[model samples]
Target: MMKRLKSRLSSIVIAICLPVIVVADPIVGVWKTEPDRKSLISHIKITACGDKFCGRILSAYDASGKEVQTPNIGKKLFWDVVGEGGGKYGGGEFWVPLINVDAVPQMTLQGDKLLVKGCEHAICAHQTWSRL
Candidate 1:
């Protein structure tokens, strides 16, 4: 019957479009990084870059929560990050501005908090950032 054929076609269309409709990753947003040693915090914006993800510094604030000028603004902090589902992401390069080094980074997202860990050679560090 034509009705049965149409119903089958509708089901196929919905199945094909469902994944595209829900493809927005939860990690795509602005996140507030933990204060550095100097007590300066930065806001990083994460967005899709190609098939991966990247984050860049959007703004910086002093310990008093006052916006400050920084030379690192608009710099890419992380790139080539791939989401591995289940709130896990890895396969990215993280830049350490303090030491001017690049490291492998792994990130985990839990609710409004993101834990970023990076290691270069024998040195390793981790920081927790919050969603802003």
Candidate 2:
């Protein structure tokens, strides 16, 4: 009887902890950014950088869908992004190299699309990016 009870307890423990071990944050993947002013798009890879969520530009392309060969490739576009769970992420800043613009961003995820809103004091901008 004791051996059977121990087996049942172990089974219950595994059942409770298995999901926590196997589950991953939904936003941890590559995402395609919306087109910029010059109609160029960027591929941003979202990953856990240090203790926070960060996205880096893996590549860039122009309106023709051709690779633009810019220095922005492999650049960290946003950092210090904290995922507060429940499809919400914030506490990050957007860094644009070309226009030299930076703003704090708040993000929400819906299905495979990420909606991000950036605000710098009174000015604000929004973009929706798709998962790649």
Candidate 3:
């Protein structure tokens, strides 16, 4: 049980060191998403937006990791995620930029990575975003 204990200890330290508000909200930060079909990756900044969580594309990079200019930059990637505790969040709208559709989102936090998924009926997509 050392792993579990260590995990608890680390969480306790995080709770003690961070401000009450910051500790309560663990998703406030920049996250780098996995590369898309075109091998393009984007940095999403998650923040509190009107009592919910919203993510916007802060920047995008090409396959070679070179920053590129695009009109879609600064667009909203997702919004309206409500925290459900235990590292779970839901009730958000996630944008499918490729198909130009919006889908319901579900998210789970795992340490420094966030598993973000979007679903519409039987269709779904997910990405693992690393904290930046």
Candidate 4:
């Protein structure tokens, strides 16, 4: 009887702890793409649409910190962010129309940095993102 009671308690504990082991949506935040020292691409809002993730262009500014109106607003910067388990995400694509570029990136959340790498089999551009 004591062994059965202990087994039941262990089961209950495991059930309660399973969800704790899972992580929340870490990519749902703001991340800026560094274009250069004088300017950067501002992804004002990063959010999940169903199972996929996307980045929205809040605004774009040029050198010397000025908001320059561009044709990229309300565009989907990233898409198809899939969970690869262990708080890592991959198999996603980002579309930046201003530059006419579309690439696949592997995403990982480390502390406040949402590291996104655009890898096209031969080349890659790393974009480090901080939560706004």
The prediction achieving the highest TM-score against the true structure is 1
- Write out the backbone clash pairs for model 3: none
Give the per-residue lDDT of model 1 (tens digit) for 1-132: 999999999999997775443347888899999998779999999987766889999999999999998889999999999888899999979998888899999999999999999999888899999999
TM for every model, in the order presented, reads: 0.82, 0.79, 0.81, 0.71
TM-score for candidate 3: 0.81
Better of 1 and 2 by TM-score: 1
Model 3 CA lDDT for position 59: 95
Query: Residue by residue across 1-132, what tens digits does model 3's lDDT show?
Result: 999999999999876665555435989899999998778899999987756889999999998999988777999989888888899999979998888899999999999999999999889999999999
Clashes of 2: 0
Residue 2 alpha-carbon offset, candidate 1, angstroms: 22
Runs in model 1 lying further than 4 Å from the true structure? 1-23
Candidate 1 residue pairs in backbone clash: none
For model 3, state the Cα shift of residue 31 in Å. Answer: 0.3
lDDT of 4 by residue, 41-130 (tens): 565577766556667888877766677787777777777777687658877787645456877868888878877777665866776877
Find the 10 residues in a row with the least total lDDT in model 1. Answer: 15-24
Candidate 2 lDDT at 78 equals 91
Give the candidates in order of TM-score, highest first. 1, 3, 2, 4
The model with the greater lDDT, 3 or 4, is: 3
**lDDT (0-100) at residue 71 of candidate 3?**
77
Assess candidate 1 and give its lDDT.
0.90
The reply for model 2, stretches above 4 Å from the true place, is 1-23
